[model samples]
Target: MAVVFDRPSLWQRVRPHLRGFDWLLLLAMLMLAGLGLLAMYSSGYDHGTRFVDHGRNMVIAAGIMVVVAQVPPRRLMQLAVPVYVLGVALLVAVALFGISKKGAQRWINLGVVIQPSELLKIATPLMLAWWFHRREGQTRAFDFAVAFGLLALPVGLIMKQPDLGTAMLVLAAGLAVIFFAGLPWKLVLPPVLIAVVGVVLILAFEPQLCADGADWVVLHEYQRQRVCTLLDPTRDPLGKGFHILQGMIAIGSGGLWGKGFMQGTQTHLEFIPERTTDFIFAAFSEEFGLVGNLAIIAGFVFLVLRSLMIAADGPTLFARLLAASLATIFFTYAFVNMGMVSGILPVVGVPLPFISYGGTAMVTLGLALGMLMSIAKEKRLIQS
Candidate 1:
């Protein structure tokens, strides 16, 4: 007698790998990615192979996200320290002998040219979350201090590279982890008050502080120029202030309903600088207008909220902290990019998530979101 054996088809064989993914998270990502493609096609129509390269980058990012989603959060905790160490080591190497492009020494030549600062974005959070996880239920001021130490090392290095935008992102990621891990309100409020007061003083003394030959010791010359330009773009509208002025003009030109796709004169005519990358939001706003901006914001809001919910459902303290902190990376990316484009913040090289044409940034975004998906997937596995 011959026995018939059952064979699993391709769908059945692959189903397990696809199971437990957060569909809502994926939906939000897809919506934003679709928007990015549209924005890129329009803004990068004549900008070399940017549109094609962007599409290729998105595909690579999506593949990475899917693969990273399979890694368990518990396994990721084990990786925290080593990844952090590797990131720090690479940063040191960059400082000693790194590539400088456009006056920023932020990239290191490691076989293939790489930006070590981007690694810190994820590593800093992972290290802090792991620290908090180990100290859970018994965390103290010293633990928070250690956490800050882990955070500050990379942030300082990035600043030395003088890439303030990347430093701010790394700092924000670590702070989110610490805050979620039960940092004291007393420690938080002082900085908040100081920052508010500092802003007030800056605005009050804009003219004196921004006068030619005036210097802000804490900021690099270019950074100072950015702040001064932000204060008044009309000062040298054709020189240092051109970016801000052009961005404002493009944004305002969109009015309520945008200029309709590729018809954006500012974008198509090359008036909006970096229209395919950092300032793509201006390009997007020019074409899609206020309504489009709202939709973009809403998509981000959904993604962030969904990530926090994933954090809340996390099975372990490490998972919760990592997920929450990683989610805020998305928040920082979107907020800073949009604010700078809208002329409310400094142009600090931050990219809008899924909407900016950047290989490094998109890869970092994929890895961060993948970690969140892993946490959410783990929770589902536990429940099942």
Candidate 2:
């Protein structure tokens, strides 16, 4: 008897791929993005086109996530070295001939203005993860030393650009990779202790350290002012402290429920600086109040927890390290931004991951989320 063969249709061929996707993670992301849109609309109501532009950015980010998620983790590992090398080279180029804006040489012009440090946010962890993966069963102290050297180069270069916020994110991401790679706590505790002591010393002698013509040897003049301002914003209420003071007032005024959507007095009256960007959380707080803030925090917590779960189930060391480090990036951005706006931390330019309105940051976040999805999908496929 002649055999009759039947070919699977297009939908059937694609169905297996679709089934591997992490729908729960996508749902969590959508929830956060929806909340972000609501907050952006309220904060940017008077600002021209900000709400529209933010929506566009989110759409672009979603596209990026979808495309990136299709790539397998092994292919991502292959790109690690090239990406890290190119990012570091661009940092060097920026040091030589970058565009200077507001006294910071952070952007490099290559037909399009690009911040190379942003690349390192992803590349640092990727390179470190790749490094550890190569040494998987044979990891040694020397390997970690090399990893630290690789990490410090870009971080040092970015700090030279004087972008503290980006530097912090990069540093935290790199450290997360190192920590997850089995770096001993004995090595980690010393740095933690030193940082704590340094902060205490700076706060105890703020008046002297912040006095006129006093040069903090390690920090720039403006950086020193930021630290002092965080300690006591009222000292320069109308000058250096204006942003923090206004942000705190807007947040405190929110009370239990809030003033209602688009009804923030501090935001409407132009008291909150960078209302649609770095300080948007203040406007969100004023409009949505404690309940909204808690909800938003819950959403972020869920996202972070979900990402960590994916990392725990990652099929390889590289996948695990990369996923965990990316989770830390999300956590650090949220923690630092909220702390800065609420007057507990020094005001740096870090934007809240999904809630803040910015194209580059949005795209970077999408890339991180996409990588997580890729890792999760790989785990699911392996199990099946």
- Top model number, TM-score: 1
For all predicted structures, in order, the TM-scores are: 0.98, 0.96
The 10-residue segment with the lowest total lDDT in model 1: 103-112
Separately for all candidates shown, the number of backbone clashes (residues 3 or more apart, or on different chains) is 0, 0
Ten-residue stretch with the least lDDT total in model 2: 13-22
- Pairs in clash, predicted candidate 2: none
Assess each prediction's global lDDT (C-alpha) against the native.
0.92, 0.92
lDDT of 2 by residue, 1-384 (tens): 999999999999878656777888888788889989999998898888998999999999988887788899999999999999999999999999999999999999899898888889999999999999999988889998999999899999998999889999999999999999999999999999999999899878888888889998877888888988999999999999999999999999999898999899999898999999999999999988999999889988998999999999999999999999999998999999999999999998999988899888898988999899899999988998
How many clashes would you count in candidate 2? 0
What's the lDDT of the predicted structure labeled candidate 2? 0.92
Q: After superposition, which runs of candidate 2 have C-alpha atoms over 4 Å from their true positions?
A: 1-17
